[model samples]
Target chain A: MTRATKPMSLTVNDRQVGPVAVPEGLMMQDFLHEYLNLTGARMGCGQGICHACTVVVEEEDGTLAEMRTCIVGAHWFEGRRVRTIEGIAERDTDGAVTDLSPVQQAFIEHFSFQCGYCTPGFVIGATVLLDRLQREPVSREDLEEVITEALDKHICRCTGYIRYLEAVRDVALKTPGLVTS
Target chain B: MKKRFVVFYTAGVVLIFMFAAAVAVFFGAFQSSVVGSEVEEPLLPDERKALAERGAYVATAADCYACHTAPGGAPWAGGLPIETPFGIIYATNISPDKEHGIGEWTRAEFHRAMRDGVGKHGAPLYPAMPYVSYRKMTPEDVDAVYAYLMSREPMPVADKTNELTFPFNMRRLLRFWNLLNLPGDTFQARDDRSEQWNRGHYVVDALGHCGECHTPRNVMMGMKESAYLQGAVLEGMEAPDVTREGLLRMGFDAPSLAHFMQRGVSAQGGMTGDMFEVVHFSTQYMRQEDLDAMAAYLFDVDDIAAAEEPPPQPEPVEVSAEIAASARGTYLNLCSGCHGASGEGIPHVAVPMTTNITLRLEDPRNFLQTVLHGIPELDFPGVERMQPMPDFADKLDDQELADLATWMRARWGGQGSDVSPSDVENLRREAHD
Candidate 1:
């Protein structure tokens, strides 16, 4: 009945991670940090109040949902396609960073992070927002609310949340398919 | 024709040179006169006394004694160890002790050290002293601080050597760090801002140096100006964001913030950790008007460009029968006495669990930590002697602690996530460490 005897499997950052046995009580944050070496998903508050340990989980309909990895059990992510902060930026065959995604670029241009401990969660959350906007575009008037709705779940203790909002706003506005005129 | 053209060109060049020379001479004289007129004369006895008194006020505003003095140590006889990522740096003794402190330092030397981050022997000071913020202080204020320190009963406390490692130990290298991060501009009253706002800005941004802790730092340890007071983690505790949105999230208004600053408690909860120290040593002693000004400025200044509607509230979570049963048992045994069976805390005695935001927050670390460590009595004026919560770390196992926390949150908060034994264990280990 112990967590150690439970079988767990999940897709992480577009890769099939495991049908590997994990402790039943193992947190997704531990699986990512210790097992997968995805340290980008930081553990700011183990209790999930600060979304510094957030990741994007793609649902059955291909809609991305943000989830706090810290509080949730690793087994909860079974059969789910989870995207981390590491998956946002493009890399070449040599694994060198070739280009940053629009959200990543926006974060850099706006200086949207300081210590960047909470950045991965913010990036992933913002990415999910951008994806949601592209799928169902909103009017310019409603854009702020949409962005707030998407990102307010994630906490960025460094950049007063203003810069991140502005960055996301910039990306949403600049990208042709995101917003209806 | 060629000779006439040459003569005209030479004549024109000579006239331009003369004009440039006159302009330079005029500016040079103006600058010298300005500098000369601003020079301080030797202080008379009454002037010295007045300046010293002003210096005492400046010292309070600057919170010089907080970092400089060790716990239970003589004022300004610094031996307080400041923890940084690189290493521990000890504050130097600023008392006017002939052998141990700044007694031999001349006024000019003191000013240079304050404004330029240079020591008496021309060595660079570590930014831990916050000379970058102090540099923004007025020359008059600096002089007053010097006079005040000089007038104090000199404590012969020797300065402790810093425990910095490797390259950081090289004091000379701090000069380079200074070049990149130091805010060289002196404090200037912004014309567009109200006088009260400007005063608040000066106190918060310059003299009080709240940003030194509240503002997040870059990899190189420079304050990220773009973020401003967005908030930052200091020694494990999140220095909660002070922005309008952040304040709103925390349920703070101007009055509440001012009250918290002055009395270390608000509707949210009482101050703890570094904030308790801040109130005890610094903010509590500030004038009520100044605290109000700070609150007003904080509430209004740096309004996030985007319109911030509070996040949509999540649907209430339901506790299962089995979990609820165990939680009830744990709660009845431990928490229900103080925080009633209905979680209706006794008014003016115990903090009501229903109104407490700590349980409602997304992270239950604070709640867990509080349960494990207990709340020490913070004797504030006007408020009753709030009874301290006893530490339950030894009495309760992880599962019991988790159950108790879960029960409190589920019954009172109505919308919080579940707490696990692992969560309780992690927090317990952290607290122990």
Candidate 2:
């Protein structure tokens, strides 16, 4: 029997990558790994329960939302903009990482992850929260709840969630205009 | 002017008299049904133990604990808020506490509460107690349940106040409502039917009170007898028509239906929403024989074991190539990962859409709601388990979601692409609210 295929094209990181032919039901995680060679999103549960395979999808309104890559189809990202863990850091003209994003920096400072298998998802979650906070700033008192609501979906088994929460909280508190008193 | 004033005064007086008479008659004639056999000699210790054991099973079948127990609270201590159209009504504490529960009540009082919807003090209970269905329970079963309840150590949880709106808050009105709705006769074994069918009918209608939710309610919020088990939409969830025809159409024979009840998951997909709670609390713990009996009764058969095989799977429907192609893209993008490329769901991860009972439902409310909101991790009995399904409300727009739903229905669902963009928007709004 012949395998069914579909044409998919999407912008990843800042580069437009294919109207390429992919398997009809190829997962975004597999596409990131095999087709684009951008495999920062790790496959943990592969059932979308664990957010280890999360990536940031840029919405039509220019808002960034975190979505699980392991469960979403490659074609689902057609004509859309996506950002993987590999694209989160600042890069030079030579395409080399120059600086880590604030979320990554905060995660390092707080030592949020232990095995680091879940770090990418956490980073994406925190980044999405930060992006939302930019558009709609949360109150100082509700910042903790807001942070929990955002990062709670991503599971980190090795390290308790305290460090990750503290790191996210610090990022939200330290950032200007993210948390209003 | 003088004649007009006299006529108006006379009319007003007549109306007042009529209202008073109506109220008096309603109250005076309203009496709790006198049920149960005459008091016999007290049972011996061993007999009493056996009775209590049977009562425990009866209570489980009745699902008394699901309603009576609050989340993370003491079992049977009540205070679970049941939401109705009118308002929220808290389930009462039926524990053996003297002050807060039914500790001081006699056996007769307990029977009356179960059958007549009347409290020990002659106060009428809200029909939320489901006494209308419990009325068919045998006196022996009622006594057994009483014994089982009385045997338990009582908690000191006081009953929470009900927050019913307007005339529903008036407990006295329930007496009249009960008069109209409550069935008088108890369950009787039909000689023409096999013993298994009668037993199944007893377990389902009397003990299980399945009709309380499965049967559609009349305008007065009473279960419609004429449409028994024909399905009802309660609290926005569609309890699919479970009549013999409905069951057969949904690819359920007696064995499969029993399996579905006992295991909570079958080839027809796992129970979700309110049915999930029922399986978790009641049917999963039921005896296999009773489950078989229920299946028999539901299938309108004499012996479930001898029933024919489940209905044949339907042929995949044909749809426009464009629609199918568009839907396949969306399905791959959002659904294919867990549910599979051809909607043949991954084992233990997701249920296959090919035989999904929800897709076959004519009303797409549950199907749309499930897709938009998604089900959390469902852990059923034994090895059957399903991972959490992610909600697509934010991910897919109304039109996209509509196309996906319509496509799924056309391909696997034995129906047409009846879902519209407006349907998605309305369902999303309702779910949000």
Candidate 3:
């Protein structure tokens, strides 16, 4: 019942982090922002309704799913491999961002975000969708449905929803492996 | 001797007439010059264009588009419904459509509407128009607004009638309301204050109309000037006090308040609810100087001491095992997902239940209303994502709502009394009506 007793550990980005003692009810969002300083995982709606706090988690089977970090406790991520927004870019030897992820680039080219607070979640969600599609490609006609299903939960109060959707669609179309012609 | 006297009297009469004529000529020349300057000359084409542009800026300051434009409707076409305790009053079309909007309204007519809350035909307009505040606008500002509105592309949307109950259905009754509340005149720059302070006062009191929401209303639903900016509930959300004492509680100073107005984020948290929309539509678009001035004025307001001592604490409700179990069940089923099991809300995300002052208010009406209707998503600049709370009205009955509220108050609101089922029902009916 006490806070200090909970066992927590996870592989964040690529590195293994903590068999650290996370207090009971410590949100994964706080664990990332406060302890790790990975602010890319934003705390949007602690309620999981706005998926702005979404991070990509690799399942035991090596498949990815978007998880809401704000609602879940840090202890819940024990032994999990999670990818945050900070891990999305391709870094050079000096850790300088060499190239942006296709989704991130697409978001930029289309001017998909205004404040960028919601961008991290959108990137994670889109990344998961792209990963899923490469394994199981959908027809071009079903692309809209797939994008909606993936990114609909993330709320972007600015730039409307159209630009974000279009950006996602552009990536899906251009990334040859995602859609069947 | 008689002929000589007659000749002298005639000469004197002629001299008197000549003096009177000279005085009349002088007065006529002075009157014409004064009258010429008083009457505004017709604007040149370039001047008209410039004035129209300025009018657009003034319109933004006045926040005309926010209330007039419905969600996804044409800008200023005016179908937005304003919810009130008495009824829903829809905003009228101010677009320049001759048939459906204000295109046919003369300049004087428009000025009268803004200054007197009277329509083109002398019909009394509802105070929902905020004419009470608009009346403080200068004639030049009013004319500029008219010019801007006239220049806009007219949307031919017909105005929707207001839905009100019995006595409120009478628009004529607003004349009486106006008589009681309206301070009929334009803004006068205070001689004692600095220019910046006076400008700030004008922006807050006239254009921004901050008191319309922040000031508590009386029994007649008129704003309580004495308690200005001390806080009040608006449309089921608490508009926090912006007065000195209230700002002090929030730990805000002039610079921070200025920053909040400009960016919609402050040290406290992101602006949410109606204030979010206000920042997005109005203050964020304002000049930095104006925002700083408003902040300066706000900071200068003398702190009103707490009027009365805090109300005596109610006896704590002792929870039996069965009652606790029931309340816990309700809370877990409905609230635990967002509020968290321990009510430790994720910072900068969902507001923590533990620190939520709404649950501990003297009147529980807002809490009940929020539960029934849910909080809507507000768009704040820089703060990207917002989630709307889903209404439990359709899902939960009165008793269930009471149980949930009571549980929340007991667990989070330390000294709060239990909310009864009847209390829930009364609030629900008030909300519905």
Candidate 4:
């Protein structure tokens, strides 16, 4: 918990980048989330009130992880790597890139977004969440709460929460063992 | 010694303050001698006649009875649910009960509610109540509506439950919303305008909220104030914009819109849905000059687009062959006797199926209902069909009447549809009464 960390070059989504300065006490949330990038991760509130900055971070050991880029530091990846949604194949399993991930597909089918502001962050967070939950499954009540909390992680001013929950429910119901009886 | 002195001084000061406050309030309450004194008489003989006359116009403008009374529920007894994006709002009892209605409302309090979107206790009303429109009424007109309501024979109805979620149940934001929406000023007579035009403008814009339905709203849900009279949709009924430009697109001129308003005929088409009902209950009752003034004001409006009307198509007259002869035979034998052969209609009244916009409409539910169950009260003198349109709902199956209607439409190149008995049955079941 107490150690001095040094900055080093790292690969982000396969792009050579970053010997970027990160504050010693700064959260990972503060680094990849700097300057004009706020435009990418949205300042839905710096207190992590929204997950518009969610990104996937890989550890130095080749193990990759999902992270809210705002609360994590850019320097945490001193010699590590990361992948972002922008890194996904323009296609899916069969070279059909329009092949949206299950979450994106479900979102469209449910008419989940009206203004579509919080969707990108939500989509990324959900992508990582689905991967994490593959090792486990949940019950009905647990499913609704986890899905709600996952999305409640962000703020949406329109379409309310019903359609968002519906989109998640669609994914959970179909993702095989994501929701066990 | 110090405690005794303080107690004596506080008592003397408190009594003087209370008396002064009471005296100031007593005088302030009667600050407007005109308002204070006239209401004392309530309705003098001449005043009663004047008020009743104005009340009729106010009633038409308000369309108060529409939401309150419903199809045949007690007039103005309330209990209708108004839908909003936020939640459903139930209409409150308007019937005079000391505990329920405005029996407790002072005239100023009533005016505030009408013009300010605030109740006497300072709670804001749900916007569905149309205070935005009422805010435009001249004070005197508001007074007239108040007079009309006060004149009604009071009925007692219990309070109904309202269900809205939190933050929305919080009425404070309404005040904030109103600050953004309601125009706080009262209507002042325009020195440059004609008396009739000024009066009509005041009545329609503010008290009538004609624009609330006609004008489109903006991002914040506020009316795009500058583009005042552009058309907007209401409960799926598209109220054509009464503005000059809007009229051109809708294919009407001042004369046409005016003529249509008087009769149920839209120059482009016939009124349907809520507008159709309004044609009978509200506008048809208006004086010719008032109708003329409304048309004039809308036509004379500055931004009218000069446009050509689309060419007319021959009217529709679809009927089923199976029942065509029998239906026509039925109409000639049974209906023509009361309806007249030409369908130009009997003099003074009786809706003509041949050319009457109401009868020639694609769906003849209201016409069919009036014909079947009969209209309430509205009887004509010379025309025999005046008493009731008589329901032959049982006699004709769906297609037989459809064929007859088809025959009528084709009779003079009129547009009509095949009436189905099921449409009749559905209408009967749906009719509130």
Top candidate, metric TM-score = 2
Q: Would candidate 3 be rated incorrect, acceptable, medium or high by CAPRI criteria? A: incorrect
Per-model TM against the reference: 0.58, 0.94, 0.58, 0.45
DockQ preference between candidates 2 and 3, better one = 2
Query: In model 4, what is the error at residue A133, expressed in angstroms?
Result: 51
With candidate 4 superimposed using the best TM-score fit, by how many Å does residue A74's alpha carbon deviate from the native?
77
Error of 2 at B297 (Å): 0.7
Best by lDDT: 2
Per-residue alpha-carbon lDDT of model 4 for A50-149, expressed as tens digits? 5666666665554335555543445445566666555543555554567677887888898988877777777776766676567667786798888877
Tell me the tens digit of each residue's lDDT in model 2 across B1-433: 9999999999999999988866964673646475845733444557667899989999999989899999898878999999988899999899999999998888778888898888889778888899988999988888898888888889999999999998989887886787778877778899999999999999999888989989999999899999999999887789989999889878898999999999898779999877888899999999999999999999999999788887777666776776676777788778877777777888876888888888788888888888888889888988788888878787788877777777888777767655789999998788767
Who is ahead in DockQ, 1 or 2?
Answer: 2
In model 3, the Cα lDDT at residue B29 comes to 21
lDDT of 1 by residue, A1-181 (tens): 1223467788987789888887654677888988889889898856455788889888889888787776566766778899888877898877688999998899899988888887888888888888888899999999998888877667766655888888999999999988999
Q: Which one wins by DockQ: 3 or 4? A: 3
lDDT minimum window of 10 residues, candidate 4 chain B: B28-37
Q: Score the docking of each candidate (DockQ).
A: 0.01, 0.64, 0.10, 0.00
Tens digit of lDDT per residue, candidate 4, span B109-174? 777677766676867777777887777666677677776776676768765677888878777666
Task: List candidate 2 stretches off by more than 4 Å.
Answer: A1-3, B1-21, B32-34, B37-50
Q: Give per-residue lDDT, candidate 2, residue B99.
A: 96
DockQ of candidate 4, scored on C-alphas against the true complex (2 decimals): 0.00
Each prediction's whole-model lDDT (CA) = 0.75, 0.86, 0.76, 0.60
